[model samples]
Target: MKLSKPLIIGIAGGSGSGKTSVTNSIYEVFKEHSVVVIEQDFYYKDQSHLDFEERLLTNYDHPLAFDNKLLISHLRKLLVRQSVEKPIYDYTLHTRSEKSVLIEPKDVIILEGILVLEDEALRNLMDIKLFVDTDADLRIIRRILRDINERGRSIESVVEQYLSVVRPMHNQFIEPTKRYADIIIPEGGHNEVAIDLMVTKIKTILENGTELYYDDDINQ
Candidate 1:
């Protein structure tokens, strides 16, 4: 069944804070339904014009690093059930790829990113705003492992980048957006109770065709 209006869920947190884990949990619960995930990483600004060294200078954790204007525009089209050619970013090249993926509109859209809720325009588009509150130590550990194993980065570089960019950016931008969230999930995906509650809430909206405001006391 098609929804009268798409449900947009914004999941935000610090780098390696289990935002992807939380997103996967929600997507798994509604996979049979018309659901799609839009990653903020895909919207990183193109650095093709810059030299390799200049691209290396990019502070990725900062809000300015994202191509939010393009992201916002694409999201608006999806909200109206229009398909968009989503940009693809190449991590190895430190810039956007030449190709784009065509994304059809869905009943549910999960916007996952470190800075998803940082911008007012983006936050306003979300039906449910979530902040995954994971500890610094755990996040750093996760970041180190993912960068080393998946991105082929050295542990030293990962640690240095986290210390010089990620940690400070989280404090200055990401953490403050928690105040705007409808639900603050502690321990990220490890918080089963919170994830269940969130799933239930989404199901209710889908079934009843109405918006339900979550109680502040239920945030764990």
Candidate 2:
């Protein structure tokens, strides 16, 4: 049997809204199939070329922070089952790393991140676009804790960043993109029913012989 081109699924939310958790949850659900995830974090521009202060001034939450052109190009190729090398970004150092990720077309392709919904071109490529809707306060608290433990940041710094950078960016870029979602899950990973519903839809699409974006009566 000929394998189909990967189905592109996009998940977007504010920081600590459980984007990765949702991706992983769905990934586990569809473990029997070949799945590849394209992380939005990997597309950060090369920060090494900028000074520390300039890099700090860079709006990481801004849609422009991502290499959207490259992402769109890669996703277009991926729709036709082409392989590509995605960048590797190092959060600890806040720089694009030298290494690259070799991504192959699979049964499923998921792209997850805070600003994934912001780019119109990228959004158009998604077979399913999901928004994880967690409240601002909860997202802030989770981000603070996660950054402290995972990224080795102090509580004070985390709070400062959240207030100065995170919140404003969310308002300006991320939150508004919720309207673009084909589906929205509240409280993210806590919504088991929604996750399962999404998984079932994906499975049904595949089982019905729909090749991701193949033109069919229902899908059309």
> Quick one: best lDDT, which candidate?
1
Per-residue CA lDDT of model 1 for 72-187, tens digit only, reads 88887887779999989888778999999999998889999999999998997789999999999999999888888887789888988888888899999999999989999999
List candidate 2 stretches off by more than 4 Å. Answer: 1-5, 214-220
RMSD after CA superposition, every candidate? 5.7, 3.8
**Cα deviation of 177 in candidate 1 (Å)?**
0.9
Model 1 weakest lDDT span, ten residues long: 211-220
Clashing residue pairs in all predictions, respectively, total 0, 0
Q: Write the per-residue lDDT of candidate 2 for residues 57-154, one digit (tens) a residue.
A: 77788777888877777776776677899889877778888899888877788999899898876887788999999999889889888888898788
Q: Candidate 2 clashing pairs?
A: none
Q: Which stretches of candidate 1 lie over 4 Å from their true place?
A: 1-3, 210-220
lDDT of each: 0.89, 0.84
Indicate the residue-level lDDT of 169 in model 1.
90
